[model samples]
Target: MDLPRHHTIRESSHRILDPFTDAQLATLGRALHLTPGTTLLDLACGKGELLCTWARDHGTVGTGVDLSTVFVAAARERAASLGVEVTFVQGDASGYVAESAVDIASCVGATWIGGGVVGTLDLLGRSLRPGGIALVGEPFWRTDPPEAALAIGDFVTLPALVEQTRDAGWDLVEMVLADEASWDRYVAAQWLNVRRFLDENPDDELAPALRHELSTAPLEYVTHQRPYLGWGVFALVRRP
Candidate 1:
């Protein structure tokens, strides 16, 4: 599916699709040393949860860019709801030129920008001020990817993922791993969203497609991802 529609679906299921939980956000905040006056940029920010939170909690100024107009509207509404001043732009994150350099930049769970992790960091680096950090949330294969599995989607092993980041001039500053419970929570949430969509749009053609996707997702995830992928978040800093 194209990115816009994919992101629309993700925005519809964000909390569930997200690998990070509330507890994990706390951990990440501590890891980033989030503070007042920090300028952050969230590339592919879905609904601007983190961006708005950072602005409110840390007094951070931020910008969030996403391709989905639906998500952009949601993000803006969230920012207003929180009474936090943050810019949420509707645009392709890969092509989004920063209005100003940021002290921290992030691409949580959307690494397609730089062709993968390494490239994403490089792109983030270019948008960062000196001594800035790049926080990337990525899924790693717990074991080596099977030939068939690798072909199924964008995936990489843990060691390989780490090696590439290190080679790309970033030092891994912090990390958080997802447990089985987290995985189940994240994936299962999708079914609820799809079900809601079906109830509201009974005659919509995409409903069946979404239903089929949700029905098969758990099995595919258990078979292909559970045994192979190790999901985690990493905060990387450009070496000063």
Candidate 2:
């Protein structure tokens, strides 16, 4: 029903919970060419940055669904602080569908909620209007990794991801990719967050676990995840 406290602590300061930076997110929003009053349904919308920012910048309204209660509360607070009226529901996003077809439907970074890419697209399709845009944020393998490294991540190559979209009867429209610097920033930030949390709460039960993660995560990132992992947000339209 809620995310583990340690997970929230590790991402304590993150607004966009993925590899995307604020500038990259803004670029993606702009690329969508969202008009005023466009309706969006954002699944796994961590911290509601996309909804709140789009509302403030593009005048689009949206609802965000996430399983993390901490993120849901933060998302609500973000919308309020931004003076944008958007709803953030703390629940399983995969099970929720809009009452009416939404102009845009997105499942970003949490595709496992629908099993995988194809299933996630099917879930998103349930909420999208005909010809509506589907924004899917996913990770792919930038380079082939060793079997042990591959065990840590499950992702296809970028070309294979594109093929998955086409195979699912969607036309690829546009995509925004995360560069190496952005990936480094994101992973490094998480390490810092975990370190800060441990520093402030050394006696806490989760501190040891966090400390262990911090000890190994940086080297792991530099060795396998960083060099081999690729992330992107793809825009697609369901084909007739």
Which one is best on lDDT?
2
Q: Estimate each model's TM-score.
A: 0.90, 0.98
lDDT of 2 by residue, 96-181 (tens): 89999999999988999899988999999999999999999999998787786797677899999999899999999999999899
Model number with the top TM-score: 2
User: Candidate 1, after superposition: displacement of residue 215 in Å?
Assistant: 3.0
Model 1 TM-score relative to the real fold: 0.90
lDDT of 2: 0.92
Q: How many collisions between residues are there in candidate 2?
A: 0
How well is each residue in 1-240 modelled by candidate 1, as lDDT tens digits?
125363465348673236777777767777788889899898888788888877888898989888777778888988999999999887889966576889989898888876888888888888898888898888887877677567556776788888888888889888888877777777777667777887888787687788788778778877776677677878888886
Candidate no. 2 TM-score: 0.98
